[model samples]
Target: MQEFALIMAGILLAGAPLVLATLGETITEKAGVINLSLDGTMLLAAMASFALASATGSAWTGALGGMAVGAAVASVLGLTNIYLGQSQLAVGFILTLLTRDLAYFLGHSYSRQPGPSLGYWGIPGLSETPLLDLLLGRQSPVVSISLAAIALCWWWMYKTNAGMRLRAVGESPRAAFGRGIRVRFSRLMACLAGGALVGLAGAAYSLAVKPGWGRPQGCEGAGWIALAIVIFGGWHPVRAAIGAYFFAALQVSGIYLQDIFPSIPAQVFQVAPFPMMIVTLLAVNLGRVGFVQDLMRRYPFLKRFSGSWPITAPAALGQDFDPKKGL
Candidate 1:
């Protein structure tokens, strides 16, 4: 039972950051802004938070710094794509490279040093539950905070008036503007908020997961996993959190079943999630084609995936100030 407890704790630790980032990304995508710089955001935030904590001995200060860096990086992307009318995909991809290189260069000094990790704080009554104590009971405040945040996010997106405006911007920017929605500003703010959330996820990794200072790869492909989870989750915060946990459990499965599957290379299981994600994308997207649609309708399961598979926003929200279109 103690061993099981430890493993569950490890899984929670692995999942917390993913949950935070995925939820944030889900919100951004829903608001008609796709900040694909999640990798660099996590990488830079991890380095900044670690370095700040190391230098100042305050994890909170480190987290703030991390958030600032992520927002700044994301704001640049917002400007290039949302303001300058550049290809959103190109801007985000470039920002990912740029911020990662910046993190690498700026954070190399702290790579070898150890830093502070966040402490866990279980909820009062719930933490004491017997079997639950092993899994959700010993969760860090970050986990509880993340869960609460996702719930609130879910509520805000699905229940509020602002959410309706945001959805209108995503669905049809011109129509939204015709209805007086401040599309560009809304999308930009959403991007900044999402980027900040991703940065928080990075802080979770630095101060909570590894509890150490390191370089760029310290984030170690977490952002890509998060981006993948965003798609797998269909851009929903609650669903995204669940996907993160699923991924974490899948990773933990390889460890728990190590002796059980001695002959099956562990690397195979580790890389298996990527292939599964690809299959998911293909199944959802290709199902829109004629023959694919026929096959998907026949399959029933693929019918559930009838939504956009885009990686970036189609327009700058409702700020369609295009002179060519007589805006």
Candidate 2:
């Protein structure tokens, strides 16, 4: 039981960065923008945050710096696509390459260098408890913040007027503009905010989850995984967080499996989670197939069990919006 608790805690800690990045993209897409620069943004942010933290000797400062880097990258993507009329895919792809190379170039000095990192801070009362300690008591602040972000985003999206306007912009910018919402501004803000979260995720990676700056970074493909989770989660914060945790569990399982079967090459365990996640994504989308649709229709109750039943992208996603053209 103690081992199980410890494993669950590990999943939560490992999954925190993913949760933040996925939620960040969810917000960006919910506002009718696709920031394909996430992979690069995370890499750059990770390097920047670690460098800043090492220089300043303050983890919080590093975190904020990382967020700034993320927001800056996002701004470029949002502005070029939204205002300059550049294709979002093109801009995002280019930025990914740019930021990635930039990180590698600039981060050479910090490779494998020791730096201050976030330490465990257990909740006072809960830290002493038996199973609870293993599960939630002894975690870094980043994990707590990641969990909180899930609820905060969900509330903001469903219960706030600003969020409504943002959703309006995503669903139909022309209609939203008719309703007096500032479509471009809302999308831009969402991009910036989402990018910040992605940056924070990067900071968390270096300062807490993986700890330290180096080549390979150990988080290379995390941004892509976060992107897939957003689609699998149907753009809902809670569902998306669940997807992050599920992936994290797969990762934890791989580690344990290595111990159980020593004959299996370690590389197999390390790479297994990625392909497994891709397969799960494919399975989730199977609901879109005709036979599956027919099966769901035959037994409507099945819809309740299938979270992907109504999953879809925002109506205006990846499309440019120009206020000057006006509805």
Candidate 3:
């Protein structure tokens, strides 16, 4: 029974962070904005959170600082894509690559130093409960917060008029503009909000997940996986949360596998996540599936769901978003 409880705990730990970031990205995409720069946002947040926490011994402050960095970076993407008439996907992807290189260059020294990490918060009486304790006795302050955010985003996106406009913009910007809606403004707001959530996701990695910060400290492809999860979740907040947790579980399980199967090469375990991520990407983008069209028709409620968003066109892709065309 104890072993059973331990296994469940392991699954929950794996699912938490992925749930946060995926749901956050899911919200952003629901508004027709995609922030590929999540990678940078996460890395920056990780560094900033770690640095601030180390300097002041306030984990909350560090997390907030990381969120700020993520929001600021996300705002830049919104500005470029909305105001400057840049490709939202291209701008976001570029920002992701740029932020990573910059963090690596700036984080050389800090990466070398180890800092305090967020200790698991064991709920007092709840943890004492027989079976529940093993399942949720150990909760991060942010896990509850993440779940709350997902619920909030769902309400905002689906239960409100503003959300309606946001969805219209994503579905067809020109059609939305024709309806007298402020499509650009809506998109911009979505971008900023998305950026802030991505930031929160990054900060979680630094202050809550890891004990310290350094180069490659805050995040690696966590942001990219968040992107995939958004698709896996069908651009819905709740599904995104589940997708995130699934990814997290895979990650946490990898550690156990490493120890259990010591005969297996460590590098294989290390690279396990990438394959999982790749498979998830392919599986989530099920447009090519045989019953995809039938599935959509059968589940009429899924008509509103969005799928994988493209970040850029090939060197010679179809028509661009021409300003002359009034896009």
**TM-scores for every predicted model:** 0.86, 0.96, 0.83
Please, what are the lDDT tens digits per residue for candidate 1 over residues 112-217? Answer: 7877666777656765677677666776666776778888888988899987776777777777777877777877887888888889888888887777765434
Q: Report the C-alpha lDDT of model 3 over 230-256, residue by residue, as the tens digit.
A: 766667777777777777777777878
* TM-score between candidate 2 and the true structure: 0.96
Clashing pairs in 1: none
Which residue window of length 10 is worst by lDDT in model 1?
A: 311-320
For candidate 1, the per-residue lDDT at 129 reads: 70
lDDT score at residue 75, model 3, on the 0-100 scale: 85
* The best candidate in terms of lDDT: 2
**What ranking of all candidate models by TM-score puts the best one first?**
2, 1, 3
Question: What total of clashing residue pairs does each candidate reach?
Answer: 0, 0, 6
Residues 1-327 of candidate 2: C-alpha lDDT, one tens digit per residue: 999999999999999999999999999999999988999999999999999999999989999999999999999998898889999989998998999899999999999999988888778788567899888888888889999999999999999999899888999999999989888889999999999999999999999998899989977989889999999898889999999999999999999999999999999999999999999888888888899889999999988866534578899998898888869
> What lDDT is reached at residue 174 by model 2?
97
Cα lDDT over the full model 3 = 0.72
